[model samples]
Target chain A: MIVDTPLLIITDLVKEFNDGEISTTVLNGLSLSLDRGEFVALLGPSGSGKSTLLSILGTLMRPTSGRFEMLGFNLIGARDVDLTEFRNQHIGFVFQAHNLLPDFTALENVMFPAATRKGRETPVDRRRATELLDKVGLADRRDFPASKLSGGQKQRVAVARALMNSPDLVLADEPTGNLDRESARRVMDLLIDLNGTDGTTFLISTHDETIAGQCRREIRLLDGRLARERH
Target chain B: MTYSFKVALRYLASNRAQTALLIAGVAVGVYIFVFMSALIGGLAVLLLNRTVGNIAHVTIQAPDRDPVSLYGRDSGTLVAILKSVQQRTTLQSAAAFLPAIEAIPNVTSVAGVVAGNGFLTKGEAIAPVIVTGVEPDQVSAIANVAGNLVAGSGDLTIGIALIGSGLAKTMGLQVGQRVSIRSERNIDATLLIGGVFSLGVSSVDDGAIYVHLRTARVLFELPDGVSRLEVKLDDLRLAPEVARRIANTTGLKSIPWTEKNEQLLNGLVAQARSGDVIKGFALVTIVIGVASALLLSTYRRQSEIGIMRAMGATRRFVVGVFMIQGGLIGLAGGLLGAGLGYLSLLPFPLPEATSSTGLPIAIGEGAYGTAILLTFIGAIFAAIWPASAASRVDPVKVIGP
Candidate 1:
């Protein structure tokens, strides 16, 4: 059987931040690749550059030096506007803080990504958002504003929002960092079930070993470089 | 609804207090603007009507003559009397020219007047007066003297005269009083004062008297002649055109009242300029108030803006959100202010009637519309800077861990 092309490729990636004459390196000569439909966990402690790497993958930050390609586009060299469009069409992001707009209802928050990209919500998109909300087990709270939801419920809404556009790649950064053990397991189970059924690619960054153990593969980053890889 | 408008409305709805304050600020500004325009514009119209209503728009008179002095005080009172006789070089057959003058476009009414100097004597008081000869119905059509009759009627019959209120008071004269009226031509008659009038102009009130046209003809020894024609037009602004047409046809010296009173016209221009300056300052206040409010709102929603950008909203979309907020604020405030302004006028009483409709103040449609439009556009422009700032928000910087 022939193997399909990988969905992501990063080589010799580096990122630096400058404060006047001083510079701090965030990602130092990192390299990684992932195939389609793969569920990979990025494992690291604080200051290990996992979040920085996730930020770059989400198209929010540009690498200082790298060859980065996603879905065949050279992401590192794309213009700002083109990058925004590419991210809108192909990438979904779930933040640790569950950055749901407080002014919008849970349903509106879940529909936000698609609404922003499409400029309007169609019937199909609304139905998909409703189904996702049902899958997340928050159908009863769909009309509640995001600020009124509990921590776990908000994170679940963020998860539903990430899949709103049916993105090709989903990047989650400490998605369950603020949730309790039971809530964390439930979020992880939801992610695993979506991956298994839809074959959607996932790259989640987490410090929890139990969460890393659940993924199909694990990549460890230390001192801005990949330290270990396991499957 | 478009995405930007929906988002903007949601943001405004979430911050109810801030949105209300913004709307109130714009409403107050618009209200003041409308009120000021109405007050100043009404005042201007009232002043113009008061000055122009009682007088003829165009006065056609005989051409100028070389100035001549008949006597000094050393020449005795008889020489003085001769000097007082107004050089009555009447229009040659004034009746035949009336038809041509009235045929001029825009001329509504034309009345032939024989104006000469005379003296009103009652008991011991004697006052020099302008004795104006007029046909009762014809003069009433050109001037508002018929409306100003304070005592007696507007009847200008033979041997009966209409005297000014001020002249009547000074000479102890009243309606039906037998008064000695001696013209400068040395003709004397004891006439009854049929009416007493006040023209609202101090000079005209103190020194004018009206008599029948035939009676004046017999007194001044000018048979079928008039010194001038008082011309009224459909529109006062069209006086010059009508007067020019009349003068060209009748060989008379036609003068519009606007040209006759240069100082009054200059004062009106200055008043208008001052009103414009006040309006300009009011608009500036509105612009600044709107801009500052929007800037603060943008700053307060910085994180929300970043969230939207991360969700694939373009910079233009973000900018459009703030602009929509500005436009809606302007529209709401404009309507409220217009309503408030019109209502406020109801409680304040008006002065005496100066208009044909018996209204002291007049509302101008064009001025009201202009005030509302200027305020609306000003508010939109005021929001641009804040909208631009909102669009420039960086998602990576704001959302980074």
Candidate 2:
């Protein structure tokens, strides 16, 4: 109940959705806690608000009423500029679709978050990005466009991009949903491997139970509520 | 914004069809703007230069009859106004011409003079001619009027009249022969012809003969007053402004020849306005092109825009990116328009087209300044809506699943 000086802490978070005359509740008193270096898996059905919770965690939306804190910055009250800076300095995200810029090569796509936060490209940023690309085994495909990569390679590049700034927290919403079973396992292993090696905490939402078994901790959501936390 | 710009550039470059359409639109707008400015500027220059060529600014004409009433101008007031205007610091030089203007002011050398309308009879041939009276030594200052007397250069020594090739052919007159001209103003006096001046405009050479103004007036028995005032300005443009001042100052209305030929003035004015209207049409086409190009471009990338917002890009970033795209299109089009217009002018040689061979081609400085301004303004205007649409992309989630 008291502050644990946690890496991420959310209390009584509620996000409501309205479809014209009808209003639907997406999250109801969704409380969660994550400490440093914790790898979390969020398992839910298609309409269970797993992605919504991730969006809130990433500072992409304001909770209807609740408290959210990340790395000592107040999430619910952050300005656009401050939130952007905070995201730049702390949070990283990977998606189910890979979502790489088709025009830029894999290396350049990985650097998008860095450039978005800081509008210039210095030599040091390039060096750091190339290092992350190497970590995700995409060093050879650095100049290849995301479209040219295999599903596994594209998701690998996505992981590289998520770690571009070496942030303390990484969010992966279905990091392997679009991949073959073998590729799904490989990307899951890579994310778990990175959590151990870099000590970067990760929160992942996945439908695959095999992917969920790979994480150190699991939080399952049912109908927009935290139904179970497995240790 | 810089990152957004980079994205915009990539987006524009990747979509070749969209980029081409936008540039084409922007270029058209730029072209119209540049050409309109040049055409307006060109028309003004033509008036200013031509007015100064034959007439002097700030002439003193007798205030007796209002020039508007057609009561005829007073040559007596010509000297008084000249003296008065000459005293003012604003005026450069003042020349007082007699009602019959037997002299050129400031310069003592008077070229061949022209007295309009004469009946010529030489060697059993009779042709109507415009009789010009010119001083023997002052032929060079007449410019085109000097070239008109190409045939009998040496005739002025013994007072033999030079005949135009056209007049010579028509009248059946030859060199060293005397022809008789009955003055139209007098109809009774016979003036001895000295030479012919063949100006290039057909009416100028075929219709005219050269004689001394003194001799022509003597033959016509005209009073010493010049029927019309021909004033020169340092810059012909100053003539209009200075003319307004003179009209206001002396209460004497002086009609510039450019004004006197109302049909020509109106025609030229209409030509220029039509040029602007054509330019407007070109601009409208460009607007349509830019609008559609941007609309298509945004439509094609609606999903990408949604994805970008999901990537945490702000609405402002998306909007800024699109705006920059518009700015770039406008800038590129503007540059192209200016370049195309300038290139087009290269074929029109000012020396050949203008009466003044010495008329400096002034396309250098003003044109460049105009192109830069037009390109920037036009490009931004063309791209504005499309870029705003980009900004209006509410975090692709609204548009995307």
Candidate 3:
């Protein structure tokens, strides 16, 4: 189902940090592109700018210098509000910490992105959230508060939430970083199954080589730039 | 409910203890505001009632005559003529002005009074007194002489007079005892004591006397005129405007009770201003409480806010969630505090003139609407800073890096 169309393109992306008198470059002229429905793994060691690149790609942070376009929209210089609307409709995120609202139930957590975009929760959002929870194999735990859920269950709920809006692409940063081996395997299996069944593109950052091997394509970063790519 | 409000509610519900404490703080502030308002309002009403209860709201007296020039217009020489010192100016044809005075809206009663300085002599114990003479039936028209009578009745017949308890005690006079009242005109008459009153005012209780209008006219040699006219109104607050109208209707000098009690009015205004300052401080406390608590909430929910932002929720949405939390807290606290304030003041008894402990707090005057509105609006204003701070949460920092 993988299309040859370019879902996102990043060119000469540069990011730096300034601390008073010292300057440090995090991303130096990084460039890459992802095809539609591609399950890509971003591999890097610490301080390699994988998170920064993902942040820039997620429209959460602006790179110091770069040309970034996704789905034919120029994202590098867009207004924050307009970028937020674009991101809500077309991009989703799954964080390493599984940052679910601890006060909300699993079902509510899954429905949050769509509900927030629409200003209120509709029955269709509820149905889709329920179906996503079932797809993630936690439909029975949908009513449980996220804080009460185990680490693995929380990560599964995060995955359901990321896919709630049917976004074209999902940027997952260390999605299995905190999970146990079995939990991480199950989460990766769910992501791969969803990619095959729904044709949703995924760009996942991971430190584990085993996790990187599961992706259809693997890209490695060194000194903030793409060092190598294997398809 | 909207997603923002739902998120706010979930946040509050998750930390029940903290939310309850925050609401309690706001409630206590609102309670203080409501209690202070009711107490101050009641004190003002009590003071007004005590001061003007038995006094004329508007008094009509004869206008003073201006001295005339002795020179004729053709002579072109002015000579000042002094006013007559012996003659006491009286309101001539005072009965003719009663109808016009009574016609004023809200005027309750009017009494023609022959007021003059007199002496009460019982044996060799003689005391100077201010005499107020009114018709027998209208004896208590201007003052609550009948209601405050300590002994005998307020019957001011031809041979009967009323005196204050202090005067009676001073002269060793009792009801039905005969006493001689002599006017400044050197006219004297013997009358029996009809009533004794204690109005709780030192001057009136010590040196005031009430007699029949016919008796006073005969004694003061004013058979065709009264000294002044006393007019009472349903509401004492309307004295100034009513006084002006009465003055204009009848060519007489009219004075309102407010003009005579300027110092008391000033004191009341000062008291009210102090109360307002206290109420304003209560509102400030509410604002501070809501702001600080919401700021803490924003900090505690940083990662969650970051996640929502990364999920493509707008900064405005994040701000909306926090602001809604503040508004809900304020509304709940306001309602609870208003109810508690009213219930707290309910057991206290209404003020009475004779009651030793006059706790003048009118529960009905708690200004509930004002307190609630101020708290709600203040809390919303308080949320602004914390909400903005929440909206500035960097998703990249909290979510991963």
Candidate 4:
């Protein structure tokens, strides 16, 4: 069916990676969809294609076979320049490892992308970065380098960094997987709050059932295909 | 570009060791270039002043005449053409071009005297000398020969010769010694050594002997004929132009300072050229050092570079950041080396009183501009590969588990 209301539509996505002398296929003809302002989660066992689908959907990787559309732009055959512009304008990514730039302070890291987008960092960028750091509960630690931040705090800063350009879609890959239960719960609550207040759409890949249970929709992957999806 | 530089600064600040290494690499090149040039410049000044400085600005001789090899052949009579160009009263073959030259705006003082080759003898001690026969007044006007005389200058007369210090030692002849003058000329006779003088040049002081023009003419059988005319101009540097004028006007063989001793002049040029070669080698080394340091640092940041690309930085931005870092290192090192070189030359002392051995190490204003350009090139050449490699990275592999 032609889905008119869908924000992201993926049809038959496949991925392969070579492990030493052996080639391994990670995904096989997978299909998925996400609507506007929808907070969704993909859960799977090890070696399943949940992370593969998330990466392909986020435009960080190319699928072997598939056509995906985000906000009316075709990513399947788009040039690198177009893809970069799209990624910069629309997608905010938070990886599982909380990969913050170790050299910059929490606030500077958050403001880095904003300055890049605007061509120069004005006073507004600084204010917004400061406001976002406050939102991540790092107002006091905003000046601290990324290396100094705790695991939970680093993840929070990554979240602030992702949202710097106010991207419409935030793709988070196992963001709270490295956190303790209390920290994971707090991070999950922050995601839920951002979605509720800003109406920002989100897609998270996780193994944590507690975090997944809180999402409005859950998609399960098995053997590189979508086994079931429920709302 | 500002963003790229800011990123580069941050990276350099984070890696102090790498930055320091890169700076040192560039500094070595700048130092080599400056000092090498200084050596060449110093040597050139010394040789030119010592050999050709005290001589006439332009010397006209016969067609087969050579200035440095003054004694190898019988001198030519260039006076026939010179006479048609200008008239003089008496029958002496040469005249003073001094008054005429002094009238010309660009011309300075000029004088004509006699020079010949002879052997001097004192008991068993004998020496060969180029005998410059100057009148007492002419000696004072042509060059500072009287003032440069070492022991006694006023008593210099018919048979007495003001000898170089080195020759004085070798001949074992002291002042007031009765010396025999031998020449293939008319008035060759034994005479007294009235005085000795040093002009600091080994050639002028040691290899030369001087007497009155009248005595030399008598000794050489050239009663009323002069050997050559010496001309001077307002600026010593304009010798070539004045020489060209002399050659054109008099239609005779005229030699300038730069041309008189060609091989010896080439020696100084070769020295200056070596300085440039040293600088070139230094810059090349800087390129190698800078390249290695920047490459290592870039490779170390594989994961971070991936993260940056994943964060939506364009490939151009990725490469620019590293290149900017290289430029910073070069500029900083160049400035520091220049400052150091300038300060070092402050107490520059030379063993020679007039500095003929080497040019003291004062930093040339022009050199800094050259250094700044080279340093930037050195630094950027080092960083280019790393920046390109960083830009070539795949974000997928970078952020992969």
Identify the leading candidate in terms of TM-score.
3
Docking class of 4: acceptable
- B-chain TM-score, every candidate? 0.80, 0.66, 0.86, 0.70
The prediction achieving the highest lDDT against the true structure is 3
Supply DockQ values for each candidate.
Answer: 0.47, 0.27, 0.67, 0.41
Candidate 3 contains a number of clashing pairs equal to 0
True contacts preserved, each candidate? Answer: 0.50, 0.17, 0.74, 0.32
**Looking at model 4 chain B, which ten-residue stretch has the lowest summed lDDT?**
B82-91
Expressed as tens digits, the lDDT of each residue in B280-312 for candidate 4 is 887788778778888888889988888877777
Model 4 chain A TM-score equals 0.93
Per-residue lDDT tens digits for candidate 1, residues A79-132, read 878888888888888888888899999999988888877787678888888899
Candidate 1 residues lying further than 4 Å off, grouped into runs, are A1-3, B58-128, B178-191, B214-256, B351-367
lDDT of 1 by residue, B1-401 (tens): 88778988898899899888888888788777777777676676677667776778999887766555455567544342222345565676777888998888888888888878888888788899988889877647765777889999988888888888898888888888899878989898788889998877767789888888887887677786788888888877687787788789988889998898788778878977887888888789888988899899888888888877887778888889999888888877777777787777655445335445643444442266776788788888888999999999888777753
lDDT of 2 by residue, B261-347 (tens): 567557667766886676667666666676677777777777667656655566677777777776787677777878886776565
Q: List lDDT for all candidates, in order.
A: 0.83, 0.67, 0.90, 0.75
Model 4 spans > 4 angstroms off = A1-5, A18-21, B25-129, B133-148, B154-161, B166-194, B199-203, B210-254, B269-278, B351-372
In what order do the candidates fall by DockQ, top score first? 3, 1, 4, 2
lDDT of 2: 0.67
On DockQ, the candidate that comes out on top is: 3
Model 2 TM: 0.75
Q: TM-score of the candidate numbered 3?
A: 0.90
Across A1-231, the per-residue lDDT of candidate 2 in tens digits comes to 123579988999998988999988889999998988888899989888898888788776678989998887778988865665676568778888887777778888888777766665557878887888888887888889777899899889888888887888898988888999888888888888898888898999988888889888899998889999998
